[model samples]
Target chain A: MRKIKDLGEFGLLRELGLFGQKLPEGWIGPGDDCAIAPKSGGNLAITTDLLIEDIHFRLSTTGPRDLGWKAAAVNLSDLASMGARPLALTVGAALPKNLPFEWAEEFYKGLRECADRFDCVLAGGDTSSAEKICLSVTALGDMEGRSPLLRSGARENDDLWLSGEPGESAAGLLLLEKGLSGGKALEKCLRRHLCPEPRVELGLLLAERRLANSAIDVSDGVLADAGHISERSGLKVLVEAGKIPMSRELCACAAKSGADPFELALGGGEDYELLFTAPPKNREAILEIGKGLGLGVALVGKVEKGSGVSLLGEDGREMEPKRSGWSHF
Target chain B: MRKIKDLGEFGLLRELGLFGQKLPEGWIGPGDDCAIAPKSGGNLAITTDLLIEDIHFRLSTTGPRDLGWKAAAVNLSDLASMGARPLALTVGAALPKNLPFEWAEEFYKGLRECADRFDCVLAGGDTSSAEKICLSVTALGDMEGRSPLLRSGARENDDLWLSGEPGESAAGLLLLEKGLSGGKALEKCLRRHLCPEPRVELGLLLAERRLANSAIDVSDGVLADAGHISERSGLKVLVEAGKIPMSRELCACAAKSGADPFELALGGGEDYELLFTAPPKNREAILEIGKGLGLGVALVGKVEKGSGVSLLGEDGREMEPKRSGWSHF
Candidate 1:
């Protein structure tokens, strides 16, 4: 009879996972970015994200459209990591009665924009009134005959590749928190924070071509996501902090604001970038695919015969990393 | 630009459904119990329900196990009405930091029980801390090649039927609110409110055998659900007050307490009973099936020409029913 506060989010998940096994046929239980299930002999990937006010966002700063985009984006990121073809999405919103109808309309517009951008359909969901805004988006996708990339498939010598910018979203959050408005520099960071683009095309290419051995989306920072791959694959992940991808805008803003760029890239969360592992044989092809898709691909780290994650600085020295992710407890 | 409060829940849905209709292959949008989608040429029924504290239930009255049960049951009922085989479920929860650990464990236990009872798998979900306890459950089901019974399929002159005891759950809620405990008379009612059994078997039987023309579970009372059928099918539905089957226990309790049993049957929500329409030729077969399943079956109404729902008193006079259900504004 332990309390939830004592157990923390991860502890509770571990406890819940004890019962998550014993999945039915056509279904694989929890432990991945999304749950993969066979529907009528075809595989479908499903993922869900819970966005809460104050914990994940504040109404004062978050607009209606951005709130909706981030909600769908977070779940879509999980879908992207699985290399699943987007199909349908369902949104359950618990909002206050005083919330404007126009706000909901704008929210749907954003949600629909993200869905339509990836050619996904917005399906059905339930709505209710609550004290604070709470949104839960469930995104469903088709595997398109290709096996989904999982967090557990990395080999001992796999090269870890990252797609898209890391830490820019967090840097944007820092800027907003400091009440710094204006400048083209700040707008890019703000967009990263407010609306993220899930790397669906890159994930599909990785899975379809069998390039990536393992995959995950950067939601709770790169270090945390890499750690998930390490824990699940039973391998050590060593990330070269200097090699972590950061947009030029993010670098300039970080330097100007007196924040360490490497630290921000290592520990800033909610970038929605794809962090995946591929064997050396696929390196050239992976780069070609990334370029073809117009996404930046960086070989930031490698998997080894060990456990947990370690970050190495440009000087080949390890620095104490900031704890990644927000603990709900 | 209408405000959400001004538009009400139905209007917002109408707006959302504007986009919902543009679904991908093998998928039908909103305006029904669940969204029907094709996966590998077979249809999957997807439905979601949002349960919020104080709005859907109270922490003071509901134990965590019951909370989980209701959350799963409500969504399962939607799946049941769609005549889908329960496959997997996803739950997204928003909770307070100080919530008890025992409560969460108990909640999972209850969720597992319901899933196991129906041979459904417990998939993964996302959890976060919020201002109040809120749960969103998405239920997925396999329809097994049979055309699902939609709410809009009722033919004119169809015989409407009901399974199980109506108003029992609401009666139970009344008992709990009035602080009435420890009586056999109240035990049945309380159990109905606290733990509702989704009529999966009956719903499956109706769909598999192609007996039911239209189906919906009684969640927002029988009248409101009937309205859904009428609105979708564009046919007049007449429900006789006397035919709405109530248990003998309910009759005795209602008479003793001077409560209107008929009103309770029509307006009391969360009954989780299957209310469906079948042709006259299928009535005998339906009763046989109900008898085999050990469930009560009664012909309670009829669908005919015209529109909207009309309730008849025992004397054959029409009565204006009280509009029940939460209007999310």
Candidate 2:
């Protein structure tokens, strides 16, 4: 008789996930933002992301345009994780009755700005009245002729790669929550949290070159998301804690706020970066791709023949973390 | 400086509709659930619909299963309007944290049931927490080499045909609101209000045989939806008030509740029925298609060389309705 809140979001998902288990042939995953069914000749990847006011964000900390941009960005980030070229996006918004028309207009502007930047179209959506704002964005991507990078494709002995820094977004959220502002690093973290970019180009490059074995977006922090790949692929993902990438801004902000940088980097969520696995042979190529995109790429971990995720301290031993990651419920 | 509430949903849509207007080539609409781009050898139609608790439905009157069914049906109805064969659907839900896990299970069951019946796969979705339950469903359909039936294709002198009765859903809602239960007719209205069947087969038939010139599903009431066709097609839709179809259940429920059946048929929303325009020459064929599907079809109006929607009284004079339609705002 436990409620969903007691079960938590992941438990509820696990319970309900049994329904959509019978996916069509050639489909990727209910586990990895499934390919669903093939459209025409190309594989189509679709993912929906929901953001509720107060739960996912606060109107006080987040502006209307940034809220809009982040909404689209998060959904697109799902598409990017699958190595799919963005095609179209639809937004379903439930806004308060008293919301300004100008706010909505700016929201759409940000949505379109992100969609346009990612070579996707803002096709259509629904608008409704709600007590609090709730936005749902569904993004569709074309895999073209490339095979979709799935979370279940990782293999033992594969190198685990991560793009961009992971902890800045969580650090940025902390600063916003504590009403701490000022300083260049703090401002950068705020922007990182507010306007997180999707690695669409890197995903495409990986898919095109057939470099990645498995991939997932780092939304629920590195530990939880890596655990996703581990669970799906039935392999262990071991991360070298010292190798975890943290931006200069994140370190600076963590120092100023007296927060654990490693904790934020590992367990804090809302980092829309990509974490993927590949053979060590492709390491040079991936590094080249990252350099081409002018994005920070790092070799953070390795896949082994086991299960779940583990973080190793600088001493090369397992590290017990205070928190693993975030759960919506 | 007007708020969106003052602007209303339609007015706000008009104001913010300027962005995303420059759709890629071969795209059908920002107007008629636009085919943003061609996929493979077919046209892809996508639409998103949002249903918020208290605004779109009341948890007291609606069960979780029916709520799930209606959420899927409304989106499928949009695909039906476009004469598109539904391919897949993604649901984005923001549920109250304290909701029962069993409720979510039943909801997914109903969602899958409707999607399965319509030959659409429940591919993927996002789940999050909110104060109120808000469901957003995005439906994808393949036109399969047939030209998408746009809302702008209705021409002058075309016969405007409607499938099934319009007021039943509204009448059903009336019954539910008043908590009037008992008689078979009243029960039917309540069922209609709770569970609506999307006309997927009929839409496919219309598209496959090229019968409907333009079409739109009536969610915003027949009069309001027909107005969409009229405005998009650059033609006037003249609906005979007397010809507005009402089910036997709706009539009985209206009489007992002392509500006007015509008003309910014209302005009461959530019909989820298809209202379409076809050339006069195709009337017989269209009727035959309806007969084959075992669906009720009514030639309710005609498309003229004008704009907007007009309801003519039995005396052949234009009648002013008490309300044009339901607005979310």
Candidate 3:
């Protein structure tokens, strides 16, 4: 890929323009000062996230396409966590002086792919020069008269669940570290790590049906993400170690690498899966929604009256995890 | 100042909790997974901007407080140009590993002051480590039943106008570069440059009343900013150079420094003023609104039948300005 500097400023924008196409619902997309979308009621959900080079991803291991995908995914995940329908996004990119044009083009291509898949429009954004690459995306969504599912809404006895398998991304990272080529399934895992899919549709379904009491995206690993809900809701959470879903391929890969699947499941970051809590009565409904959406749903544990998180091991012993998840600071 | 690293991840958020003050109606201020605000008929005005160290501002000249203020102001300015009312904002700051904690606290203090002034709330944001300082802010606002006032809305014969004086920032920059210090009047010019107040209320009023034919913020200098409206609106803008407002202090400082005041007025940036165009019929209404707000309004030009921007000098001769203004690339 060409460096971003080769594209200059206007050139980079022209490159971005190619990827930003028409939206699914005739929504005006990127290139405008800001995007406009119709909301069910009168409220709009907004969220922003920043991805710094080296800090968020390494150029050597992650491609520009993956970087772009992840940048949008992180912000979209935030919107999804709120149970808002993704509508539009604006990106703020700070490119290094020596960046190549092709790199930027590929980056936007990846971002466009994600936007198309989710039926969202690429809205306006700002671009500037920096010492290193930094991408900040702000996503806008429609709430549609539903109360946003917040991290502070989980009640005691609420069943905790995740949208998909937890440890695939971590397992992929381990394989990459071991100098293993991501062959087929391994590539899929690596892609999952680098370019996570934001559970937008599932989140909308959950909100539409009023099934989820609380929700958060798992960018900072399961333990840390769950910890966020626990801290916000003033409740304790207990995870059944054996019940946490793990992909068969991921388990095999973890075993081969002599890594603990449980540890990765607890502390690995960048999963981007929706971790949510719902009442016991809503279990079947949530399961049906997940099945209809083709999204994996795992019954991980339950919310309790206390504070902090506890792990119940296979031997029926409670243990505190060695560490929480990734901390940005 | 305590170093940000000392606060860790959640600790930093805990620190942010101290600034969780209430906001105007319909604003769900920061702290949740995402921010939500009421929009006019369900449409939102959203924008995101990033300020990188050295690239956007120098720490030596700009204080932490002003840095915080300007960071929010830039994005707020974008929303203002769209005629949106300030709602809530989320900040993402990447601090250098060595930054002290007190700096962060003071930064937030300044940010809080500005947010309060604008009736905005400090929503949740992210903090991380970087080699140099970088701040990214995303602002969301409500349009309140009006179509966004875009740069593409100008038409021929429309009168171009601006709020307040121009070139203050440029004059201040010159003074700072020359190490000139300490006159009360000079200090005002410097403060204007350092902590620009976005014309949010004026923009909102103009949009709500449908008074502006086109609008843009004076961020990249009048010529360049006007050039955007010209290009987007496909209208020729003939700016009357002698009519552009200039503060007496700026004029005197420029004269003392043997600099051309016209050049400064044309090419100086970061003024954070509103540059807009309106129909001749709406001129009286706009002037009344300006008077009601106690703000200065100057009619500087008229839209023409063609494209591109031209300036009429003091001698009634058209002249191309030497500087086009600041370019981020």
Who wins the lDDT comparison? Answer: 2
Residue lDDT tens for model 1, A119-209: 8877879888887889999998888788889999999999999998888888889887877767787789889999999999999889999
Give the alpha-carbon lDDT of every model. 0.85, 0.86, 0.75
lDDT of 1 by residue, B1-329 (tens): 45566767777788766434666666767878889877765688988889888888888888888878878888888989999988878999887778887788888888878887887777878888887888999998889887888898999999989999898887888777777776787888888898899999998999999999999999889999898898899998899888988887777566655678776788888999998999999989999999999999999999999998989888999876776774755
On lDDT, the stronger of 2 and 3 is: 2
Error of 1 at A223 (Å): 1.3
DockQ scores of all models, one per candidate: 0.66, 0.75, 0.16
Cα lDDT over the full model 1:
0.85
Q: What is the lDDT ranking, best to worst? A: 2, 1, 3
- 1 against 3, candidate with superior lDDT: 1
State the DockQ, from 0 to 1, for candidate 2: 0.75
Off by over 4 Å in 2: A18-20, A320-323, B18-20, B33-36, B317-323
Instruction: Give interface RMSD (Å), model 3.
Output: 16.2
TM-score of structure candidate 1: 0.96
Q: Model 2: per-residue lDDT, tens digit, A1-329?
A: 76888877667777887434776676654667545468776878888888888888998999988988999999889888888999998888888888888889889888888999998988878788999999999999988888888888999999999999988999999999999999999999999899999999998999899999999999988988899899889999999998988778999999988999988898888889999999999999999999999998999999999887888899999864444777788
DockQ score for candidate 1: 0.66
